[model samples]
Target: MMMSRCDAEEDPSQTKKRKLCPSSGLPEEMVLSCLARVSRSEQASLSLVSKRHRSLLTTPELYKFRTLLGCTENLIHLCLHIPPDPNPRWFTLSLKPLDRRLVPVRSYFYQPLDAASMVAHGCGIYVMGGRIGGRASSSVMFLDCRFHTWSTLPSMGVPRYSAASGVVDGKIYILGGWADIVV
Candidate 1:
């Protein structure tokens, strides 16, 4: 019997084997649901297990699922002043499954923006009222943790640097700082 071009190719149904996923052979959807329940702080470790896990852990769908399931976790971010570097570096402390160590996070910096007041609220770090080019500035910027991006917000009424800021009842209050005295 002569074999035709189509006959030489194996039937997909016959050659394909059922793939048992790493999650006990459960479907991808179910695995994602279980993984989504993990605290966001620990997702980095999960992401290192495999490429599939990394893809699933970092997807927007998984984050949305976490929100829908009420599994969101809050992280504490701190700006550390390292010697020889005037610009402060941002770090986040993981909570839940609780990690006390600080993990470095990405942030944008503009020269001469030191002494800015920073406060965290609703998945964002607000940096407001700082010195720009060695002069008092009223510029306001926020870093969105979810997207790791920076955006500008309305500037404060007056330029202030080295101010104290904190969140009270979800409201950010900027307290006293050095202000430019006009002649």
Candidate 2:
């Protein structure tokens, strides 16, 4: 809402004109293009620019557009766990935009699954069954490394811990890690 389009009133005494996006006086598509060209590390900082910019950056369309424009880059994710810590931590190597280092991702939304099997497929990392609270879990979660987000997948038929898994020809294969209870 550059003007009075959204009914959001501005000071009548002010005479300055407002463009589409206050940050960049460009169209939405062009803005997205420019943002797509920015390094992954800098994207998070850009999100603080404005609500519109943050929303636009989070959408899947941004990455798709980046791919179409050949502006994508390689990113590495590192996961580490040490004794005395309840869960493992995830980090990504940030190699651009003035600050280049391993940046920590806020993974609270999707708590780490201890001993969970992980396999990389395209832009997603699948976390298969593992122990949750010292008990076997049947839940499956998918992590979109692009945005450091996670989504829950259908739970497995049987709970598993320390499962062995992999991707074969676009299909996932899980072997072992389930047990039967006998009364």
Candidate 3:
């Protein structure tokens, strides 16, 4: 006699359980962590392979597992200035680990700059004065990573370009740069 595809053939002598994931032989939670590390682009293809993959890929619990595993994803932000366009445009690209696929994000900072000093504080990227039309600039711009917006901060004492800047203990420090001082 032949059984249907959905039917499970069983024997009274065989009571042992079968492994869920054939590749890893790990628990479902551990398996999810392994799957979470895969790039987002591949997750869609992997989902098509099996029902288990689809469930794990779409569920939020997989992301929770990623957090538990301390997998911190880093995003790369790039600022571009094109001629004729007055405002500088900001773009962000997300690079997936292991797979190394680039995913572009919608958010951006609306500010134009030829050269500027950038410093990261917490979740903010601060843009200090840069050279504009062969002159030093003192305009301070702040880019908030959380909301993906730009705001102006108090200008520095002097206009500087290509200045050195850093963040320490939540404080931002701006050092000497190409400043035009007429004595």
Could you give candidate 3's per-residue lDDT for residues 71-115 as a string of tens digits?
Answer: 545667767665787756666556755545443322334464666
Report lDDT (CA) for all predictions: 0.73, 0.76, 0.68
- Residue 10 displacement in candidate 1 (angstroms): 20
For model 1, the stretches where C-alpha displacement exceeds 4 angstroms are 1-62, 68-71, 96-98, 108-112, 167-170
What residue pairs are clashing in model 1? Answer: none
**Candidate 3 residue pairs that clash:** 88-111, 88-112
Clashing pairs in 2: none
lDDT of 2 at 156: 86
Tens-place lDDT digits, model 1, residues 9-54: 7677844453445746665656767887886666666766887887
Ten residues in sequence with the least summed lDDT for candidate 2: 12-21
lDDT of 2 by residue, 8-71 (tens): 6768555344235556776576677678888777776777788888878777878887788787
Q: Judged by lDDT, which candidate is best?
A: 2
Off by over 4 Å in 2: 1-26, 82-85, 94-100, 178-183
The root-mean-square deviation over C-alpha atoms between each candidate and the true structure, in angstroms, is: 9.9, 7.1, 12.0
